[model samples]
Target: MVASLLSARGLNKQFHSGNQPVSVLSNLSLSLEQGESLALTGRSGSGKSTLISILCGLEQPDSGRLTVLGEAFDGDAGRQTEARWASLRRQQIGVVFQEANLMPALSLLDNVRLRVRLAGQDEDGCRDWLERLGIGELAARYPDQVSGGQRQRAALAMVFAMKPALILADEPTGSLDRHTAEDVTGQLFDLQARYGCGLILATHDIELATRCNHHLDLGHQPEA
Candidate 1:
């Protein structure tokens, strides 16, 4: 049987404020299968970002069992675990942050090329991904030279180029205007359908959340 794309059980996290600990996530658990899309809906400070961080292995959960693509991590931050997560991020996982995380020094095309190389994908298709996102003309521009929406699109192009088994997107359209956001949102869905990858995205837009295959509200605040 094919392994599940992602699984988290009894995940917990907290943040320290002065001397007091603020609860963020309490015994949170989620699962995803290939070709599935899950939307995380919650207000600000509701641990949406915190959960995303933990899911991507950027932050360690206080306690939990996490299995991604058959590799398991159980509250242990060993070197081998770190190495495994790093490898997964490089190859099987695609992360799209709220703010486009692009290399300032490289042109958009080159950045996508780098991601494809790191992900062990075909670099020849990198520019094609940019073209599909309506940023082909700006491929030669540096991240700083492009507008915020354009830069975000380039970041998305990098993700699409990698063709990862799982995608984690955080507030993907947070900065764009309604029209642009909708455009980008459509492209995101297109990526999922065409690639048949599992997608987990955090968003405050109820309309967006409803479009996903599953909705998971953190419940720290009113649902979006």
Candidate 2:
């Protein structure tokens, strides 16, 4: 049988708003196979980020079972060590945040090289990845010197350079204009397909969500 790249079951999460507890996720479950793309859509406060955080090991669910690349984390297993999660983030998972994911102090090329190095990948092709993302000429520029769209392109180059098994992108183009968003997301999908990596993208854009192989709307029940 082909092993799933990521799997989660019966996820539950809660948070306190003032004195009342709000249930953000209840018995949520999802899975991603290699080379598949899953889009997560929901309202602003819908637990989309929370779910991604849990999946990426940034946060633990109150109760659930998570398995990524064959490594398991049972909710009953208690809190996992930082090292364990760090190892996964470094080697198997590549995450792109909505903004400021690049190191402001480093030049674009250096940032990609650093990320690739951390993933234990060769840094030689870092420049090629940046060029593929359409930011090659800006390799020597710092993050603050580039436009928001360019910076995001650099971030994508960094993520793809690592050749991660699973990619979790949160609002990757939320700050860009319509045209730029389309351009960036188009490259994202194309590169993802070329790499044959699993992708889970959380976005508020309905049209963008539709491009993925599957869609999960947190506003309603998840589709089977």
Error of 1 at 64 (Å): 1.2
Q: What CA RMSD would you report for each candidate?
A: 2.4, 2.0
Q: Tell me the spans in candidate 2 whose CA falls farther than 4 Å from its real position.
A: 76-80, 222-224
Q: How far is 220's C-alpha from truth in model 1 (Å)? A: 5.6
Clashing residue pairs in all predictions, respectively, total 0, 0
Q: CA lDDT of each candidate?
A: 0.90, 0.90
**Per-residue lDDT of candidate 1, residues 1-55 (tens digit):** 5458999998888899999998888888889999999999998888888988888
TM-score of candidate 2 relative to the true fold: 0.95
